[model samples]
Target chain A: MTAIPVQPIVSMRRVEKIYRQGDSVVHAVDQVDIDIFPGEFTVLSGPSGSGKTTILNLTGALDNVTRGDIHVEGRKLQDMSRTETSRFRRDRVGFVFQAYNLIPVLTAFENAELILSIQGVPRTERSARVRDLFHAVGLDGLEHRRPSAMSGGQQQRVAIVRAIVTNPAIVLADEPTANVDSRTAATILDIMERLNREMGNTFLFSSHDPQVIARAHRVISMQDGRVVGDERRDGNS
Target chain B: MLILMAFRNLWRNTRRTAITLFSIGFGLMLSLIFTGIGDSGYGRLIEGASRMGMGHVALIPRGYLDTPSIDKRFDVPSDLIGRIQVMSRVTAVRERITGQAMVATANDSAGAAFMAIDPGTETPETLYFMDFLESGALFDPKNRIGIVIGRNMADRLRVDIGGKVVYTLTDVQGEIISGLARVSGIFRTGVLQVDNYFVLLPIDTLRDLIGYTSREVTHLAVFLEDHAASRSIRSRIQACVDEIPGAEAVTWRDAMPDIAGLIAMDQSSNYLFQLIIFLLISAGILNTILMSVLERKREFGILLAVGISPLRLFSLIMLEAGWLCIFGLIAGLLLTAPVYGYLHSTGIDLTAMFTEKPDVGGVLFDPTIHADLRPISLAVILTVAAALILLSGIYPAWKASRVMPVEAIQSA
Candidate 1:
């Protein structure tokens, strides 16, 4: 008998995203089907305008799917109302931006605690969870530092902590390593992989950087708004 | 978190925020000074009109204020006078006879309106003869024919402080009468109407000359501790008049409608000016807030993507406006207090600005301007300012709320 397969945390079915440029319709994302499984560290690698970030956005419920369905943690994103969609994003998926967009007014711990606070987690528990995560992510002493005071790599690490604090269905990072140096990018990839291994957290990244793509257990390649290749590999190939 | 982020975001662009704050503060300070000056100036004009002999509240023969002459006289109701003198806000009650007369010096003659008074029976603080006496002495109680005249009348009549003059008028029986009097004092009021046309006589002397009994006078003038209390006090005095017969109570506004009209007109113009200034400042502030919001589109996107609701984002913007209003009001008060202090105290002389004498509808204003900011006026102004500033933020806040995370993030 065949082994049973674990349910995928996120699944997209032939999704198409269309855009209107006044006089013309552009297929920004077309004929794309993807499944991001639990504990999978995956990369959607492509050149500019290749719809990698678009796919990540669709999975994160940050953008609407045009013609097909997207199920994140088994909740249909397009069918969600505005409030429900926001709650879905809040409770399910976490996002890490390429620019390390930490709220400048908040300290690192506070930044990581923001989602939990929004979820109405008690203050002491929020503090406990944020502190433990800060320690686990190698950001032990910088919990109180604002984004402006930290190095770029350290800021990205805090951003990762912010993304994974809820153990969400997937952490969608759009070009997460683009702005950092190679060594810092390596460190970020290491921390992200460690998060997946130790916590069973799922992550989906959109990056054209070969170094970042090389560390992912699965690589989905796209060009001209179409998926052209899918390669699954053993760890750290 | 919303408020914290809002206040911190304001400081992120410190120079821009400071510049915007300065604009708000400067506008508010200017408004306070303008309004303060208008209040004090109107008060000064009103008191000046009152002292010119309207009093704050007055009781006269039923038709005296409408058409006045020495013939329309009333007996001094001692009971009514005593009742009013003891009224809570009453400062003093004065008896006076006002009539048009002719004063002829040995060398010259001019028409004058004479007011007969018993010395020390009026608001001493506002008595023109007592306060602005330029030379000589006030009337001696023993001398029945002593009088005081203004400097311009003295000049027009070609008389010295002690010069002899004759006053002529028609009394109650419609008979012409003349009495000889010595000028005991001369006062300069800097008001052309008062200085050129007014004369003060002893009550007994005028009564005897005009063939009136001791208790009969043309008018009874009631003074108060505060002139602004005139309306309410007038009602109280009117209620007393209703109890008695053959008299009517009138406020200075009714007694001197020209002065009241002038003040109302001036205040309306001042309000219009303030409204214009408020609109301009609101526009500048609105634009500043919009630019601040537009610049942070992507930041707002990051927030929205992280699950901050649109309503929360809108509140964050409004909180920013509230904070801006608070800071601006504080800054404005800091700038205004000292200037209002100096203006209210030492006052700023406006003599040079007076190409002509500072008279409006026969009333003279002192050249120096004083500020009189009421506490309620300050609260009203601040509340209005805060409302406008907050109103200025609504559109920007709505715009912030409607931000699309994908487009906004990609736009960056």
Candidate 2:
């Protein structure tokens, strides 16, 4: 008999992360169970404080679970040290945020080089990867431009390039299109989708935007720190 | 690349960068200025005092400097001066007799400390006394009654060169000896102390006039090749003196405790000023770094949101501050060269501003300032400035890295 696969790329088994605020405990992520497969585009949607971002953070290994096991690629989050978590983030996860946190002092190419540089990639290879990512994000000639000089849409595109430049196992995008116009948001979604299909990479995001939700292969609805609905789409690829 | 980025950022925020630079620049300038003034003035004072008849190093009868009594005189051997002259480090050695006396002429009388020297064995500074000849020649040792009067003493006595001056003093036997000497030379040394109360006479004549039977001497004045080698040379001389009976050696610093104390006090004051300047620069740098980091809270949160570790973010802030420090150093160093050069050549004269003069141990104070580009001072300043700037970034960077991405995004 063939052995069954045991764990997903990112899986949280009844995970809960609570924070203490003065006198009361906040259920940032309460009894949340999640499994994100390889090569899948998933979206977690909710209102403010609904624990969508917390779940994404836990799945990305940016935060440790308070109660339950959070495993990424068969490695338990509880067992990982701070350095190991940082390595996991460095080599196993990528992130795109709504604020497009590209280093303002660094140019588009330099910002993208952050992850690659820290991973000890050679300068030649890092430069090539940065140029390719900038081209892929439709910012081919803007590699030398700083984030401050670029428009909101252009900066967001550079942020996407920075997130994916390391070619990690999973990309976590938290409201990546919130800062851009509808047209630019569509293009950003299309690039992410194309990258997902072409590179066979996994992408997971948390957003309340309808456009972001419509583009996902799977949608997980969250309310009050718990998943309310899980829906999968089989077609429209 | 971080350096380049930091430079651009500093230029972009020119006003803020200028404030930070000024903080560092003013600190550098203050240290240079005060230290320059002190170094220049003290150096002049020491050199002036040493050259005014006394050499860089001196040898005196052991207990005579502490309590000068005729009984404490040392009978230096006739061959000892010749032996010291052969030593390579010995520039010049002259025997001298020093005593306190009341000198009088027909019109006036003044109390003074008299230094009697062999005019033939004179150094250039001997000219500070004998060169301003009003009439007759300076004292010749063959003539026991020839004396050179200082200009101020001459004026007080209502006498000039060729006039006769009367001197009465109690001899070593406690008997009063009265005599008259012809004023052979009249001179004006620039120094106030020497011009007012000093009277130069031939050593042999003074000895005979004091009625000493043996070749007993008050002190042996020594000048060295290198002033800094005084301690070692003094020790060597002391060793030699130890081999011989009834001899002692003393360095100029030991010979003059008050002068040494004056230099120590100036050095301590400079150290205190340096510490205050360092603290001021540190506070300024801390304020700038803290403000910069606090302003970029949302930016740092976004960086963490995109998987940049908090440690790396912290390093980035430190690197930025380090780069700023380098800029400040470069600017400060560049500005130092011309200012130091100008001040070194033409010292800031404060004589016009202050009518009341300060004296450092008997030496009059002057404001002529100078600074040398010492490697040690430069290294110390650079290290301190950089450290202050780096230390200023820690708390702000930590606070920045802790910014929550979710909250930052929501707020944005």
Candidate 3:
């Protein structure tokens, strides 16, 4: 009998990104290769300036690679135009940032359902999905409150719900817990883990927090714009 | 949802928004009020000039306007005058003999233009003699050869009311003629040229002096109920008058191109003033929108990263500007309405500004200035302000939309 190999959801081969400042050229993201698969709660762990956020940006098509190929869901991101790249990000991926950047004018429910709205989902369906996600993230009664009225942990929970409400193939979080308290960070990680397990959603996060590193099922460590280690813990470590 | 967001965002900085609105609203009100006053003042001046001596339309011998002499006189039959008086829109028609002459008293003499008017046939509303009568009565039927002279001319000739004066001029056959008349009234029109040069006498007496027949006259002035209808009335009267030999009709616009030019210049300057006001308002709006865009750089980046397109962001910014302009427009109209009402009803007294009635051209303007707002002018001003506000938003919106999401998010 022959074995069938499953393809990775995101593929990067020899990706490089360079920046020119005045008369100096710097390699912000050097030659590197990685693959992210489905239903994995993975962490990219590195010190400052290790190119972790750059790699995540490249995968999300928010930034372009200088000299290599990047494929998200088996399609080459480099081949897309700027508009197409934006559409790709809109349709295929969700993002969580460190600042909990919800639109100030929108309520919690509105912030969560914005992506579904953008996708032209009917009003009823969008409301139902946002309500369910809000419930899952323990934000059921705070739906009408704006970000300014919510606590830091509650805001992050809303951001998480926003990221996953569209049910994209992956959620890329850049330092998502960097601004929250330790207890709030733990709560955020627990919600992410449960969502990853139950809804079969993939999460790729960049963080140096030890608590985040300890909860990840897979940790890819990087140093000086290059991957130094890849470790997988067995059976939900 | 976008509109709601834009509206709410405007009030996030309440002080800034209030200041911007005040600037736009105040500027617009000032522009509208000034424009209304200017238009009303010009309208009064034109109407006054037309009614003073030059009627809205006039009939003259074809070549007489170019060179005024006794030889260029034409006969206007009484039947033609009766026909013109019965025409629609023609209020009155009066015949006059205008000629240059030398007027002399016992002590002094000066060159003057004499207009011989038939006082019995002329309308009191169209005659300047009664309005400016400084002393003595207007021409009396008891005194057939009575004359009315401007005060400046009276001063030049050193004559008073009831004083005897002699007027001399050349007649139709190249013969010099002279006539003796008593000054029945002395009038003072505020217009310097009219006061300095004009002398009035009975038309029949002047005709007898100049050797003209009974029906012959230099010109006939036609008055109209609506001054604005002058051009069309002139054209209608011209069609009939042209059949008479060497007869032509002229509208006041053609008779006084300098006054028409003055009106055009006033209108153009009003438009320029409006432009300046709108530009100032646009600058205020542009500054507010640009600062809002700058402060929301990170918010815009997050929006882009979450799938909102740059074009959508641009529209959002422009929507904000549109809301602000609409608020400002409503506020301005509301604020200006009562002030305009007051000015239109009661008028502004320019007596404090000018000690005497000012004469523009040959027309004297009253000291009380009333404002009149035309609907077309109001619509034009509002439309221009709205357009300028929208135009001011484009650049800031474009700048906001063109920002790269990643760099924006990374920057503080």
Give me the candidate number with maximum DockQ. Answer: 1
Please rank every candidate by DockQ, starting with the best.
1, 3, 2
Instruction: Report the Cα interface RMSD of each model, rounded to 1 decimal.
Output: 1.1, 2.8, 1.2
DockQ of each: 0.58, 0.42, 0.54
Give candidate 1's whole-model lDDT.
0.86
Whichever of 2 and 3 has more TM-score, that candidate is: 2
Report the CAPRI category for model 3: medium
TM-score for each of the candidates: 0.86, 0.84, 0.80
Question: Which prediction has more favorable TM-score, 1 or 3?
Answer: 1
Which digits, one per residue and each the tens of the lDDT, describe model 2 over residues B112-210?
777778877775543334445555676775777878877778888988877888876666776777667888887664446666787777777666767
lDDT of 1 by residue, B246-301 (tens): 78788988998888887888889988888888899899889988999999998889
- Across residues B292-386, which tens digit of lDDT does each residue of candidate 3 receive? 99999988988888877788889889999899889989878887888888889998787888756687777777778777866667888888888
User: What pairs collide in candidate 1?
Assistant: none
What C-alpha lDDT, on a 0 to 100 scale, does residue B211 get in candidate 2?
Answer: 72
